[model samples]
Target: MIAIGFEGSANKIGVGIIKHTPDGKVEVLANVRHTYITPPGQGFLPRDTAVHHRAHVIPLTKQALEKASLKPSDVDCICFTKGPGMGAPLVSVAIAARTLSLLWGKPLVAVNHCIGHIEMGRMITGAKNPVVLYVSGGNTQVIAYAEHRYRIFGETIDIAVGNCLDRFARILNLPNDPSPGYNIEQGAKRGKKFFELPYAVKGMDVSFSGILSYIETLSTTHLKTGKCTAEDLCFSLQETVFAMLVEITERAMAHIGSSEVLIVGGVGCNERLQDMMGKMVAQRGGYLFATDERFCIDNGLMIAQAGILMFKTGHVTPLEDTWCTQRYRTDEVLVTWR
Candidate 1:
């Protein structure tokens, strides 16, 4: 069976086609993504981001289909990221998916954004029942499979880790060509000093709002006094925050008694973060699983891969129930496929 997935939950618009065989093999026929990059020192607005998705969805869908060497009629299902994202962007992509479903007479599947990341990670890495650390601009959670559902072990109490990094990048007027986080990572590579920053990790949950606030103040002070370079700030921020993430991940791994760790979501692509996590898992004599930017970052393939699993289990979203939301929790979805 072939599935076409659409993803525009945030600033990225992606289209992917996947083919699943009866023997339980999955092939990524095509996975195309285009990001809506804003100017330096600026963040994306929902309205404008929605417009970007609306304008690019058709072209991206066409490219994906072409790359897959399949037509819309050949697709068995249309899958899309339905919630836990920017409302406008989600709706824009949903409209496209709904239209395609109607136009091609295919089934529609509404996928949770977070679950898509997890499922894709599992599929790509073949990490069966491992502790998952999902981090993105809007979300940060440590999850594990239990009782036929992906349960949250821990999450952010305030702003997400990726949001903190992006906001800090804005303060530094970093280029958003690839991504704010990517630029921050590059700057961090040049850093030599380690500045003391607040590290907030309370039990299983973590908080980044206080850390972000403190970092912003430090950035302003540095601008006036030149006491610290931007590279050092980036380095310190990454070290402090990623260490907190690794600490919580280790705690979760210990609690679950599972040595395997899988990191998903956009922030999962950071090399430094991965290095930190790898060391932590290695110290425990465990293994760490991670995917490259194509699968780690927001993409239609993950959505398609996850949606196909739901479709195979006889799940379908009716047109009337296709309204998009911005707060769909990961643990809310029932794991029928598992």
Candidate 2:
């Protein structure tokens, strides 16, 4: 069976085609992505991101098909991210998926964004039942599979880690060419000093708003007196926040008795974050599993992967139920395939 997935939950619009063989092997036929980057010190608005996705969805789908050397008739299902993202962008992609499902007479599967990330990570790394640290611009969670569901062990009570980094990048007027977090990572490599920042971790949940607020004040001070460089702030922010993340992940691992750790989502692409996680997992006598940019960041492959699993289990979203939401929790969906 072949599945084409659409992902436009945020600034990136991606289309991917995947084939599942009779022997239960999965092949990624094609994965094409385009990002909508805003100017320096500016963030992408929902309306503009939706417009970008609407304009590129068709062409990207065609490109994916062409790259996969397949026709529309070869596809068995249409899968799309349905929630836990910007509502406008999610709806734009869902509308496109609905149109394709209707035109091709294929089944439609609405996938939760966070579940997509976890499933894709598992597929890529082959980590069976590992503790998952899902961190992105919009989400941060420590999850484990229990009782036929991916249960959340810890999450952000305030802003996400990536959001804190992106806002701090705006404070420094960093270029958004690839991403704010990527720029921050690059700048942090050049840093030579470390500045103290607030570290807030309450039980299993973490908070970044206070850290962001403290960093912003430090940035203001730097702008006034030039006491600290942008690189230092980026380095300090990454170190502090990443430490909090590693702490929570370690706590979850200890509690769940799982030594294996799987990192997913856009922020999971950061080398520093991965290194931190690697160290923590190593101390527990386990390994860390992470994917490259293709699967780490938002993409259609993950959506297709999760969607195909659902479709095979007799799951399909009706037209009336194809609406997108901005707060779809990961644990809300039942993992029938597992």
Candidate 3:
């Protein structure tokens, strides 16, 4: 099956094309993305991001098809992220997908954004039924597949880790061109000292709002006093938060009796987090799976991968039901194929 996907749930807009073969082989024909970057200390607003998506979705789609060396007639279905994202940005991409569906006369498959991340992570890492640690700008959860759903074992009680990192970057006036988190990671590499930050882990859940607030004040006071550099703060924050994530993930693994862990989402691209996770997994004599920025960050190909799986199972979204939402849950979709 050939699927073309559109994703614009956040500041980035992406278009990707992929094919699933009869022999169960998957091929990524094209994956193209464009990000809407804001100035330092500024977060991307939904309105501006929606405008960015509207401006680039068409060109990116064309680029994807051209890279795939295929026409619209060759695509089997039109796939799009249906929800759990910024409302206006989600709607902007959905409108494009809907129009393409109508124009190309292809069936529509609405995929849950979180499912896209999980499915793509599984496929990329070839980790069979591993504990999943999904960390993105908007979400943070430890999950496992059970029965017909991906059950959430643990999650952030307040803001997500990525949000915390991004907000911290804003406080430091770091550049957001590639991503504020990436810039923070670079600074973290130069950090030689680690400051103790609040580590909040409540059973299987975690919290970051307090940590972010605390660090923000520390950055303000310490930077002015020349007591701590930005790198020190970044390093400290990464270590503290990643340790929290690793702790919860390890707890989830112990509960589920799983030896393998797969990391997915935008924040998963951070090498520091991956390193910390690897150490914990190694100590447990288990394996850790992770992807680089190309797959880890929000992109359309992951949506295509999950959408094709749904389409293969005879799933289709009626035109009337092709709506976008901002609060879809990970366990909401029934995993019939699994």
Candidate 4:
């Protein structure tokens, strides 16, 4: 099966064409990314980013098709992120997918933005029934697979992990132009020892809002008194948050009795977080798997990869199913795709 995927869930607009061979292997023929920058601590503004997507999405889609050397008719299906994203961006991306699917007479598959992350991890690592930790701009969750579906075990009671990191970058006066995770990773790399930042871990859940507030307060205090180092603060902040995640993940692993752990979502790309997870999972004799930016952040290959499998199993969406939403819970979705 061959298909095209469109992802405009956030700042980076992506399109990918992939082929699934007879032997049950996946190959991405073309994957392209076009980025849009927002003000500090913001991945997107509904008004501006929607207009930005309108200008580039059509051409980007065409380029993906051309680069893959495949036409719409050649694609077996058209897939896209249907919900759990900005309303304007979701509508823009969904509109393009719907139009293409209609014109080409291809099946359309609507995907949940967060589940795309876990699916990417499964696709990349070939790990079935593993514990899933999905962390990104909008979500931070510990997930488990049950009865042909993945369900949330524990998640952020407040702001997302990626949002926390991005906000931290804003307080530090660092560049938020690229990914917030990348900026924090870069800032932490230049530091030595960790600074003394607040660390909050509560049972199976964690809170970064207090830490975010604490860091901002410290930043202001340092500015006024000139008594603190920037590098140390970044290092401390990264350590605190990563530790919080690691602790909860380890606890969840034990609670769920799963030995394999895979980290999904864009925040999984962070070097320190990966290191922490890798170490924790390894210490407990478990596996820790993560994705590179290609699949880690929002992209089309994951949608295409998941769509092919789902569509093959008759889990496709009809034309009447083309509606969009701001919230799509992961647990309620039972995988009709085997």
Candidate 5:
């Protein structure tokens, strides 16, 4: 089946086309991502993001279709992110999917942004039952699949990991809209020592709000005292947060008897996190899989891959289920595959 996917959940705009044959694995015919950092003054431009989707995704969609040797009419389904993202951007992608589905007489599949991440991780890593660590701006959770369903073992009690980084960036007057993680990574690289930051761990569930608060206080107090550089603070912050994740992931792995570790979502692209998790997984003789930014940072290909799986299993959303919301539980959707 031929499918087209639209992703505008965040600052990035992406369009991907792919097809799967009964006897062969799914193939990515074309995958393209357009990013808008939105400069330093603005946090995020809602109108600009939508315009970006309209201007970039439409053209890229056409190109992807052509590259796949198919016309828009040949597409069997149009997949789009349904929720757990900025409403403005999701609206843009949803509208685009609706228009295309209507124009081409194809099914519109409302793919959950988080599910897309997990699906893409599974497809890329070939992990049947791996421990999943999902870290992104809008989400932070450790997951596993059992009894044909994805289950959340642990998650953020308050702010997400990426949001913590973004808020820290905002305080430092650094660019945040595209990715605060990148700037923090660079800042950490320039750092000389490991400073102390809050490590808030309440059992398996982690809380980043405390970490954000602690970091902000550190920056303010250090500035008043004239003692530390932003680079040191950034390094310390990443170390504290990533250490928390590594600890929790290791605990989850031990609890669930899972040796394979798969990291997904936007924050999964962080090289430091990957290295940390890689070390922990290796010590236990486990395999670690992290998607590259091409797939890790959110894109249409993951959604398309998810749609194909849902289609194969006859799991579909009715037009009534087409409605989008900023909040939806992963467990709310009935699981048909592990």
Candidate 6:
């Protein structure tokens, strides 16, 4: 079955086409994305991000179809991210998906954003039923598959880890052309000092609001007083926060008796975080599965992969029930396909 997916959860909008071959292999025919970049020291707002999606979704859809060498008539269904994202951006992509569903006479499959990341990570790395650590700008959760759902073993109590990094980037006036987190990672590479920062790990769960607030205060005084360089701050921030993530993830794995771990979501693309996770998982005599920006960051193909799996399992969103949401949880969806 052939499927096309639309994703516009945050600053980036993406469209992808994929096919589930008769032999059971999935083929990614096309995957493309356009980012809504903000100026340094700025963060993307929902309204602005929605505008970006509305402006680019059509062109991006055309590009995806062309790259796949397929027509709308050839696709079996239309898939889209339903939620756990910004309200406006989610609605924007949902409307596009609904429109295409009606125009092409295709069924609509609404996918959970986090599940998309999990399914794509599993497909790319061939990691079956591994403990998942989903880290993104909007979310942070340590999950494990059990029964009929992706169970969240741990998560953030406040802001997500990626949001913490992005906010730090804004304080440092880092460019957001590619991504604030990417720039922070690059800066951290050049850092020579490990400035101290708050570490808030609450058992299985973690928190970043305290760390961000403390770092913001430090940036105000430390940067001017030469107590620490931006690189040092970035380095310290990554080390501290990633350590918290690694700690929680490892704890989750231990609790669930899981040997294998999979890292998903946009922040999972960070080399430093991957390295930290790799070392931890290695010590436990297990494997760590990760992907590059192509699949790691928010993209349409992940949505397609997850949606098509659900579609094959006789799951389809009715036209009236195609509404988007901003509060969908990873454990909310029944994992019937699994």
Candidate 4 lDDT over 165-261, as tens digits, reads 8887777667666666797788788877666777677777878888889888887887578676777678888888888888888887898798988
RMSD of model 1 against the true structure: 0.7
Model 3 TM-score, 2 decimals? 0.99
Q: Could you tell me how far off, in angstroms, the CA of residue 234 lies in candidate 3 after the best superposition?
A: 0.4
Q: Write the per-residue lDDT of candidate 2 for residues 181-250, one digit (tens) a residue.
A: 9999999999888998888999999999999999899889885798988899899999999999999999
lDDT of 3 by residue, 1-338 (tens): 89999999999999988899999999999999999998898999999999999999999999999999999999999999998999999999999999999999999999999999998999888999999999999999999999999999999999999999999999999999899999999999999888899999999999999999999999989999999999999999999999999999999999999999999999999998999999999999999999998899999999999999999999999999999999999999999779
Candidate 3 weakest ten by summed lDDT: 118-127
lDDT for each of the candidates?
A: 0.95, 0.94, 0.95, 0.82, 0.84, 0.94
RMSD of each: 0.7, 0.7, 0.6, 1.6, 1.8, 0.7
Please, what are the lDDT tens digits per residue for candidate 6 over residues 94-125? Answer: 99999989899999999999999999899989
TM-score for each model: 0.99, 0.99, 0.99, 0.95, 0.94, 0.99
**TM-score, cand. 4:** 0.95
State the displacement of the C-alpha of residue 93, model 1, in Å, after optimal TM-score superposition.
0.6
Model 3: residues with Cα > 4 Å off, grouped in runs: none
The C-alpha stretches of model 4 lying farther than 4 A from their native spots are 39-43
The regions of model 5 sitting more than 4 angstroms off are: 45-48, 176-178, 224-226
Clashes of each: 0, 0, 0, 0, 0, 0
Which candidate would rank higher by TM-score, 1 or 5? 1
lDDT by residue for model 1 (130-246), tens: 999999999999999998789998999999999999999999999998999999999999998898999899999999999999989998998579898999999999999999999
lDDT of 5 at 211: 81
